[model samples]
Target chain A: MNTKILRVNMERLTAEFEELPDAYRSLGGRGLTSAIVAAEVPPECHPLGPRNKLVLAPGIVTGTSAPSSGRLSVGGKSPLTGGIKESNVGSRFAQTLARLGIRAIIVEGQFKEGYKLLAVGKAGAELVDASQWIGQGLYASFERLEEAFRDRVDICGAGVVAEMSARNSGLAFNDLEGRSTRYAGRGGLGAVMASRGLKFIVLDGDGAPGVEVEDKEVFDRGRRKLAEGLKAHDVTKPGGALASYGTNVLINVMNEAGGLPHRNFSSGQDPRAEEVSGERKAELIQKRGGVRPHACHPGCIIQCSEVWTREDGADPMGVLEYESVWALGPNCGIYDLDTIGELNRACNDLGLDTIETGNTLAVVMEGGLLEFGDGAGALRLLEEVRRGTPTGRLLMHGAAFAGTALGVTRVPVVKGQAMPAYDPRAVKGIGIAYATSPMGADHTAGYSIAPEILGVGGKVDPLDPDKGALLRGLQRATAFIDSAGYCLFTAFAVLDFPEALEGMVETVGGVLGTPLTVDDVDAIGKKILDAERTFNAAAGFTQTDDRLPEFMHLETLPPHGHVFDVPAEELDAVLRDG
Target chain B: MMEAPSVTVRLFARLREAAGTSEIALQAQDIRGLLDALVAKAPSVGSELLEADGQLRQAVTVMVNGRNIEFLGGLDTPLRGGDTVAVFPVVAGG
Candidate 1:
């Protein structure tokens, strides 16, 4: 298969196609983005300056019927985390770009004085002047881009928050059904795009340039078997638990395991827990006019997306995921699911990271700005962000920054990125992931839930930090699997059935016309990590940069009454001598 | 009212569906005795929750009041007045 790179110079409104070199054909998605960012962009450059470049690449299995292979990676120097940041978003955009025979799109340099939207399809590329799209929310920008692209296209765009240079801004994308449900929401890459004066990206495939694959029979057989296996598994199958409840399935279980982050990591237990539980959310969806869990991208067998609506059945928003729900629901002390749904919708509309925004709001509330569980106050705070009020500007700067503005020190952040739902003091395995991952404070980066909480692979004690070495190994494996574009949930099957990984690599090699062994898979993963680590090192992140928040070690969590006992020296060993 | 010496041990999922309710009344003091009584009352749930050696199945988690038995006193965790013994089939997915 031949890989093509679409290079767009926003300043001159010029575009060109560059074919993939022999050495780079085997690389795409995380592999391609990390490599390009490492090789071309200077590590010490300002993340949002003209010196930085935003590299967008789809996963290796994207455009193919490989279960959940539609994840797209947006990689650049991060304005938020200040490290090698590659955030994944699942939308029709990745599949559309793959169908256009494009492996990656390297967006370089800032545009001339005004805003513009970059549209790419199989027909070629163009930089359309979009001064009209300035100050628009994500939904409005998407609608305008759709109108300009003749109403049918995949779009990857930023919101007004991004244009305003909010530290928590995100790149929003449409789900399979065209709601803005998918988010390339981590590491503040949207800030990088906004800095380039690129407001939005519209992808239309009026023309088709399907990627080539050798040995059609082998590829077809592999695809059929993989989809069948997805159907067979309860997790990704039709009408499965994930379909019924979305990722909120972890709500009750994680809470039961005493790992749910509640009241800004003050406790693992919530008094009004049932109000936000997955079972309750499922029931609420049935009552409200909302869609149950569905795929974010087409041809995805693992449909774990859900739509949430107001109580009166009006303006149903996108998926209410685990992280967002926890961030908006328990962490902020808001128990009403409708309030959570509205907050989630507001974040998507504003194109802000829900995790970071929710965390920032919680930090402010904890500082006595508002009473805990004040849903009304939360709404008002979000409105302030919309109007770009002074308080709003502080909130937009993210959790750590907001905490500093409030003169509070209990802020939970890793390398400038706010922590997600799980408290590190409770779920130590994922804590290790948050402390060690190149992407700051991202649970999905490593996802220690399978063993630490859910006991899927093997029971790893949640309170024990003895498995630090094992957690790092799993993180490496997970990074490779993610780069390959396979859904992380596939690990459940891959762990039980080794043939699953073999099948995936074989199918990837079959499609790309390159032979890939399991060992090669490991090496590819190591290379991705090396590129990220090298970039972070040059960007001035050191061993001390990886340490968890100071409050985690001092404050003892409730129920278990345990503090983060993993010695900083031991945490340092995660990347040390490796 | 009458001299009824028994207790109801609750099982969830398939075990409960077979036992006909979340809880079952059985007369047993120890874990082994509880299984024997459960098998005497509802044979199907007994087979699902226990192995031939009378040990609990690894796939099933037997908890008393949200605490895993293994983490607590194991089978020796003594039952008391109104003790809620719950059995849950392991359900792991996405």
Candidate 2:
């Protein structure tokens, strides 16, 4: 099998394809990304400097009809973490890139130009002038790309917020039929892209050759069985719970379990919780003509992406899921879905991580920037990024920096990455994940919602710390799964049916022409984790770096009323191998 | 007075939805005895709640309050007066 790499130099505006090393042939997703970044990019270079390279990789299962195996990983020196950072998104990019026989794309150096976009396809690469599109929102940029490229291509673009060089900016991707629905949306990576003078990336897969697989028959059967498993499960079946309500389905359950973060991680339960819940969201979408939950990718069965609409239904905002809604909705105390939807639209247009933006806004409100639940004020704050005002620059830097500028002591971040909606104090397992994960407090790293909230894989109490070791096991398993190019939602089926593992390994072996056991799968995951840890340690990270905010230890969440009692010493046990 | 036969029944998550009540009162002496009594008394709820082992199935959490009786007490948490048992199906959301 011939593996190819595309290396683009921004300073010289040059590009080349290099042969993959024999060792990297088996690597996929995070394995490929972490390894490449650790090897090629210097650990101590300024993250936004020309020395840093952004690596985009597809998983091993990419290009196959595997269920939910379309996540693409983007790795670099995180502007947020200052450590090895890899963020993945469930977009068509990975599947498309894999089908085009592209395993990884390495973007290096910086373009001297202030604004530009890169267009890639089977034909090759081009530096497109983006002057006309400067300050364009994601939706507008997507619309323009669709108009220009037609249905022949997919586009990855950042919003005007990135052009302004805001820290919270994220790179957004066009979903199926060209909606700005998916995002490489975390850790201020968009700012890095903007700093490199990259405004957008358009991938045209038209006429591209498909991926090569050794055993098509075994691939077909294995993939089919895995698809059947997802179809059989309630959470993963088409029009399943995720499709019906997006990820906001967690609102009710998390509230009942007392893990929902309200008013900036200060409490667990919000009396206004229902106002932002999945059921309520479903009802609101129905009333507003924006209710349909569509898939982000063309072949995705679990359609958890939604096209949020204005209350008047005059214009369609980008998709808003659990993290966005919570970040813009309850985390900042805004209950009106339309208002939250507007903020979501604004962030997408400006290319910002809604979670960080929402959390940062709440922190600003806590510092008396605005009253909590000020929906209009929040809207105005986002408008600043759109306008590229001075305050807009400060607001766009995200929560950690914004908190520092505001002199606020209650910044909720780990390794500079903002916390997702789940309060760590209430959900202790995820807390351990947040504290120990090299990527910072990202639940997607080791989502404990399964055991804590969903009752999958033997229920564990959300408030208990006794299951730290078990939680770490799940996290390690999840890391492997993510790297394999399987969608994290696939865990819903796998957790219930252990046979799914055999099916996945069989499929992998068939496609790669290599016999791989489930043990190999476990080893691949460990290798990825070890590589990331090595990068972080080399970049000056240590066990002391993995810790939750001090307030979590002292403050208690109400309504069940508990604090994170897990000692730092015990929390560190997650990194120790048995 | 005639003696009454009894067995403990557990509830957990969302099983409380079907059981009408958290803990139900049974007058049977064994696992089979309690299930038969449960099916006979709350026939509308029994088939949905109990499995063939007389144990609750997937999506069902049958715990005797603080303890998952499945691990501790089984369907026999040794019932006594005022022991509020709970039954629930696995919640659909989250």
Candidate 3:
């Protein structure tokens, strides 16, 4: 798998492809992005300044025929959290970049004037002045790009909010259908792109030299086993839970566990939450003629993405993921799916992350901007962000900043970024993930939910506080998966089937022509974590930084009536001291 | 006349579709009796919940109140009237 790094200097508007360095040979996805950012970007530089750089890389097996392996990692210093971030997304853009033999795209320097589009193709990459796309909504911007480049091209671009340098902005990637729906939506990576004066990265795959496998026989063996495991598993199998209802399936599950945050993390459960659940959403999709069991990218056997539509099936909104639903729905005391669906669409259009925007809106509600459960009111507020109102600017900076502005003390954030749907007080294990994750308040930090992973013998209590080591191992393994380019949903099958794990390890080995065994998963993942941790340390994050918000420690959540009680020492040991 | 001792058996996701109802009022004193009542109310739910070996299906997650039943003694976990038993075919997501 030979590849080169494509570096774009916005100051000069120059595009150059450099030979892939030996140090970055085995790295891909989060591993590669974090490495590039940590090595090249200054920790203290303003995230929206010239010194900050945005790096995008596909996972090691991203472009290959590996099942569900089309994930791209977009990393940079987050303006929101003042920490390193790698926001992952599933899109054809990743495969297109990987197919072009471009391992990473390092965007450097600031473009002071207007937005430009970076077009990469068989003819080699070039910069095109795209100032017209600067202020347009992403959906329209993406449509124009599709028209300009035609159907064969995939797109990655900053949204309108990102053009305004909103901290809550996320980079939108065109999904399989050319819709600007999929997002590397966690950190403020979009603003980082926008800051560099690059609005879009379009990849034309026609006549491209696709990803070459070093060992086809080994790769095929690994792919088959992984596919079989996914096909057989209950959650990932054809027409299974995820495929049937999409990711919003977790709405009811988390609510049942008393871990679902409702009304700005004030409570843990509400009967109204059922109105926005996956079960309810799937029924609505069926009645309205929308598509469930949709794949964000090709070769995704899990196919958990969906196209959410209006009552008459008119205006399709893509994939109401669990976190997005929760953050915009019950967490704001709004139970209507149509309302949440509209909010989701607005976020996609403006290039705002649904999670951060939702959390910020909740804080806005608490601050007396609007009453809770006001769906119409929430939409109007989102309009403010698009219109660049004074209030909207405050909201777009994200939850922590919004909370401070709003004077709300019940902010549910870790390291400036808002926590997702799960109330950490109820599910202590995931809370540890939120607290200790280098990316800050990320639920995806620990994807290993296996019984064996949780504990060797028994059904370990989720409320148990001694889960630091458990989370360390889980996060380590997850880092490898994120770097490998496999969808995190792949963990559902791999957790239950041993062979699936072997398949993942062997596939990477086949791609890189190096033997990586199951025993190496931890060490390899740890390497990525270590780099991120070191960068964060250099960025001035300390032991106190590795904690759930102070509000979590003081406030007891309802239903479970528990607080986040994991010891600081436990969290401290997660990195495995040198 | 007073209602018989009952626990609310709530279903979610595909489980509710199979059972034909989201909530079922079932007379029971423990998790085992609750299963019997659930089967009596919706045999489809029973088929989806248990295997031929009479063990709970691996995918099915049962919780009494908010605590997972698997951690509490599986089938033998005691239940009282007015307790809420939530069931879902466990699907992993963030």
lDDT of 2 by residue, A1-578 (tens): 43888787788777677888888998788888899999998999888888888888888888777777888888888887889888888788788888878888888889876767677788777787787887666777788787887674777776777666666777788777677768888877777777787777888888878777778777777787788877877677876667877778677556655677878787787758767777677777778887577876666777777777777776877577888888898888888777888888877777888889999898888878888899999999888778878878778888888888988877889888889988877778888888888888788888787776566666776767876677677777778887778878877777787677677777777778887776776567667787888899999998888998888888877765688888878877776674
Instruction: Arrange candidates by lDDT, descending.
Output: 3, 1, 2
Model 2 collision count: 19
Quote the positional error of residue A13 for candidate 2 in Å.
Answer: 0.5
Model 3 over residues A33-119: C-alpha lDDT tens digits? 999999999998889998999999999999998999999999999988899999999998899899998899999998888888999
Q: Which stretches of candidate 1 lie over 4 Å from their true place?
A: A215-218, A576-578, B1-94
The root-mean-square deviation over C-alpha atoms between each candidate and the true structure, in angstroms, is: 3.6, 4.6, 2.0
Model 1 Cα lDDT, one tens digit per residue, A1-578: 74688988776677899988777778778888888899889999998888899999987778777777887889999889878888887787888888888888999998859887787776688888878877767766676666666766888877778887887888998776566668999888887888888887888877766667765666666666667666765455677546766787666666665678888888887647667877678778888868876778887777788777788877768788888988998998998888998899889888899999889888998988888799889989988888899988888879989899888788989999999878888878888888888889988777777766554566666778776677667777777776777777777556545566677777677777777766776567777887888899999989888789888989888877888888777777765435
Candidate 3: TM-score of chain A is 0.98
Against the true structure, candidate 3 reaches a TM-score of 0.97
What is model 3's interface RMSD? 3.3
Q: Largest TM-score belongs to which candidate?
A: 3
**Chain B only, TM-score of each candidate:** 0.76, 0.56, 0.87
Model 3 error, position A10 (Å): 1.0
Alpha-carbon shift of residue A220 in model 1 (angstroms): 3.7
- Quantify all predictions' global Cα lDDT against the true fold: 0.77, 0.75, 0.87
Among all candidates shown, the one with the greatest lDDT: 3
